[model samples]
Target: MEKTKPMVAVVDDDPRLLESLEELLESAGYAACCFGSARGLLNHGLSHLDLLITDIGMPGMNGFELRDQVKKVRPELPVFLITGRHEIADQGRAQGISGFFRKPFDAPALLIAISEACKNRDGG
Candidate 1:
């Protein structure tokens, strides 16, 4: 039987960022789902995702709120938070995340972390 690629969900308000992350995830061999808002992601559901990467500053339901919500429903799912603002990261709201990346984050590093998180999730 063939193994399926891990599905990664990303929520970011910026369309460019969403497109970029989706392409990056796909090029790295994982399935990527992009959502423009946390509500959009929630509406679509979360059970199918292997991992989640969300931006900290969105219009409604920011990354921290979304992370809290995900923990409530799918606590085991690995979540990575990304943000362009340094102040948010400095405020220390990024606790309990699998990883945190600042915008302009190194793609290779992100991919490596994602790979490891997915592998660990599957007990591989």
Candidate 2:
């Protein structure tokens, strides 16, 4: 039997960042779903997602807010926050999220973190 690729929903307001992350995720062997806003992801639904990666500095709904809303429905879901603004990293960790990565983060390290997050969820 073939294994299914993990579905990762990535939300970022920056169009370029969104596209770049999607490509990176796909290259890393995960199914990537890109969203321009938290609302866009919410509207599309999260039934198929194994993980969520969001940006903290979005214009409307920020990553932290999105994580809260997502947790309300899917408590076990793993949410990772990525931001160009490094200060928000502490806040993201305070919320007890799966992980946080700064902009220009090492893609390989991010992939490792993602794998760990998924593994922990499965084990639990």
Candidate 3:
């Protein structure tokens, strides 16, 4: 049987970042789902996601809030936090996350981490 691609959901207010991340995740063999807001992602539901990558600074629900909401249901899903703000990164709010990356983060490193997370999830 053929294996399915891992579905990775990304939430960010910036359209450019969403587009870039979607492209990057697709290029790296993940099935990407991009949301402009945390509400959008939450509305879509988390049952199908293999992983999540969200930006810290958003209009309404920030990444941390979104992560907390996700954990309430899909606690085992790997979450990666990304942000352009150095202060938020320094605040040490990245608890219970699989990984954290600053904006303009290295794509190769992100891909490797995603690969590892997906592999681990599949028990491979």
All candidates' TM-scores? 0.93, 0.91, 0.92
Candidate 1 accuracy as TM-score = 0.93
- Extract clashing residue pairs from model 2: none
Badly placed stretches (over 4 Å) of model 2 are 90-98
> What CA root-mean-square deviation does each model show from the true structure?
1.8, 1.9, 1.8
- Which digits, one per residue and each the tens of the lDDT, describe model 3 over residues 35-113? 9999999999999999999998999999999999999999999989899986666565454334878888999999999
Assess candidate 2 and give its TM-score to the true structure: 0.91
Whole-model lDDT values for every prediction: 0.91, 0.89, 0.90
lDDT tens string, model 1, 1-124?
Answer: 9889999999999999999999999998999999999999999999899999999899989999999999999999999989998766655545543487888889999999999999999998
Q: Ranking under lDDT, best-scoring first? A: 1, 3, 2
Name the lDDT value of residue 1 in candidate 2.
100
After superposing candidate 1, which stretches have Cα over 4 Å from the reference? 90-98
Residue 105, candidate 3: Cα error in Å is 0.6
